[model samples]
Target: MIRRRAFLATCGALGAALLSRRAIAATAEVLASLRSARQRIRTLQARFEQERTLGLLATRVVSRGELTVVLPGQLRWELLPPDSITWWITPAGLAYASSRSRASADRSAAGPMAGVLDDVLVVLGGDPTRLEPRYALEAALQPDETVRVVATPKDSRISAVMRSIEILIDRDLISPRRIRMEESSSDRIEIRFSDVRINQPVDPARMRPPTEPRP
Candidate 1:
């Protein structure tokens, strides 16, 4: 617990330093730092909104959204636009909501699934190592600095719902800058953060479960 919290906070605090400065730190050192980084990341609640082009549909769709999260666990994502959807992950399990869509009870597992919260946190907490086996990390160290990690699904569900997930880590702060969620033939979902608050006080209500439907 101590180790993880420290990791999370450092990642949030040293967002800039981790970018271009390649430390003489060993791989273990680097990995250790990332692990702690993920733990201390206390909270991240922000607005993620953007306009996207769908090549398959041959049209542009605009969407606005926000997500709020608390340390080591707990999060919520709401997308409002071409389609309205909200997904919440709590200690209890996964909850998906749309106009009338809810995750089947059988599919709502307690822990974060590979493509769910674990993936979300890896990006937010700045650890490419955890997902490295699946994604190839490409980084830059020059006039323009950026670290881009791309993941190609090795399984059917991952491949069916997603072609690949691309993460953009801003070189200056070592924090996530953007996340590209792509699908084959071009329908995509991209999340760009703004008003991002890390390790700050957040509304507790945001972390609570959503209202359930009537039986």
Candidate 2:
């Protein structure tokens, strides 16, 4: 009886090890597929709805926006009227303008939030390869034919401000459907994308930096 019990215990351990290996392998495969899909995107445009919850204030704010990205480093994010603000990120740097103030500010003026914005751009880009250097990624394939990726920051600066980021990608579309950024237990931001257009032509003027004076 003692010998039989020992054998069963050893088999259970072996089975657990095999299951762990399979899970790791599955995650790796999903990441590879994400990398391949992102490589094919040169230009993308989408509409987004963002919900921000402030931990301290216990307030939730919702905004609608449009995003346009031109590969090799160019992006324009505009929040539609009622909260009209736009941010343009290019090879030069980051710049933003507010419709209310009719003023523009450069990266130098963006302060600590600039880094956070830069990280947002990277996440929106949906390139796992670019994110892997700064984040530890784990992915799972969902029953709805979507891939869910969770990224935890490795950089101290980023980790200090962000807890983790979760991205949901549609397998058939090969593009991100939603992204959730957790800043803390109570503070977080969630963005959902729709009407995504891939490899589409975008107006050059839309991506041009604002000429208004810095605040």
Candidate 3:
């Protein structure tokens, strides 16, 4: 009985030590890791699968896509199947086109929405600097060496669109593996990325939205 009691005490002490380490980890450490990753990443190309769950739907909707991002603000997200469209983002605004019609729409009225979307994309694209000041950032370094960051928006307009955002980043790879966006309407959009390629030369043409006139 004495031996068992001693073993239990040792286990309890070890658990406490581990928990303490996790609890005391500094936010600066997380920030530094993010900064390091951001520096190493200039561009990102990946295949992603997105699942959107709605409050009333019995079945969740799933979509497959390819994403490309270049530093200094450019992104192309191409959706496939059912209905196909490609969304392009630039510093100016958002543009999208239907693959079937090949007609593009330049939605300048969507500038506010574009800003919010860009903010989330930039963070997931590995540059969190822009968001750190605008959002309350809480980060935890998990046992697997991945960092989980939860960001709550400080801006009322952004908060109105999204309640919060969560991201899982691979520290060693300096890449984001998943992002979950929680909308104020109780809808959830989760995107998982795979086959990621970073800093490789991307065609300049791919960076531009479709040239066809807006419909």
Candidate 4:
């Protein structure tokens, strides 16, 4: 009886190992498909609705915005009026303008914030290859046919400020349907995209930083 019990236990362990391997293989296939789809995109534009929850205040703030991305490295994100703000990111640097003030910073001067911006761009760009180097990615196909990918920052500096980023990809469009950034247990931001136009011509003016008001 003792020998039989040990044999059964060993079989159970082997079965579990096989299941783990299969899960890993499935995740790899999903990542490969995502990478291939993202490579074909040159430019993209989308309208987004962002919800930000503050842990300390227990308040939820909602904002509407638009985003434009021109690859190899240019992105413009703007929030509509009342709390109007615009941010432009490119290889050159990061620039932003708000109703109250405007500022620009070079990549080196941006410090840790630069890393955060770069990661955002990578995730939005849907390039797993670039993200794999800095983040640990796990992906699964949802029952609704969407691919959900969770990326955890591997860099200590980034992880200090961000816990993880969750993205839901639309299988047909090969674009993100939603992105959630978890800063902590209670502090998180979720953005949902709509009116997404992929591989479209983005206006050059859209990529430029907002200009300062003339006196």
lDDT of 1 at 115: 55
TM-score of each: 0.65, 0.82, 0.80, 0.89
lDDT of 3 by residue, 26-109 (tens): 655787668776887778899999998887665688999998998868888888877588888776567777855654434567
lDDT for model 3:
0.79
Kindly list the per-residue Cα lDDT of model 4 for residues 9-95, writing each as its tens digit.
999999999998888788788888888888888998899999999999989999999989888789898999876999999777899
lDDT of 1 by residue, 48-149 (tens): 875576887798777888877775667787887657888776655677777875662323443225354556666666455676565544433334555555
lDDT of 2 by residue, 80-129 (tens): 98998988886556777886554445567755456666666666564666
Clashing pairs for predicted structure model 4, backbone only: none
- Kindly report which residue stretches of model 3 are placed more than 4 angstroms away from their true locations once superposed: 1-25, 100-108, 211-215
User: How many collisions between residues are there in candidate 3?
Assistant: 0
Q: Residue 170 in model 2: shift from native, Å?
A: 1.3
Off by over 4 Å in 4: 1-15, 211-215
- For each candidate, the alpha-carbon lDDT, in order, equals 0.63, 0.80, 0.79, 0.86
- Rank the candidate models, highest TM-score first: 4, 2, 3, 1
Which of the numbered candidates is closest to the native, going by highest TM-score?
4
- The clash tally of candidate 4 reads 0
Best by lDDT: 4
Q: Which is the better candidate, 1 or 2, if ranked by lDDT? A: 2
Q: Which ten residues in a row have the lowest lDDT in candidate 2?
A: 99-108
Candidates' RMSD to native: 12.8, 3.6, 6.5, 2.9
- Give the lDDT of residue 59 in candidate 2: 96
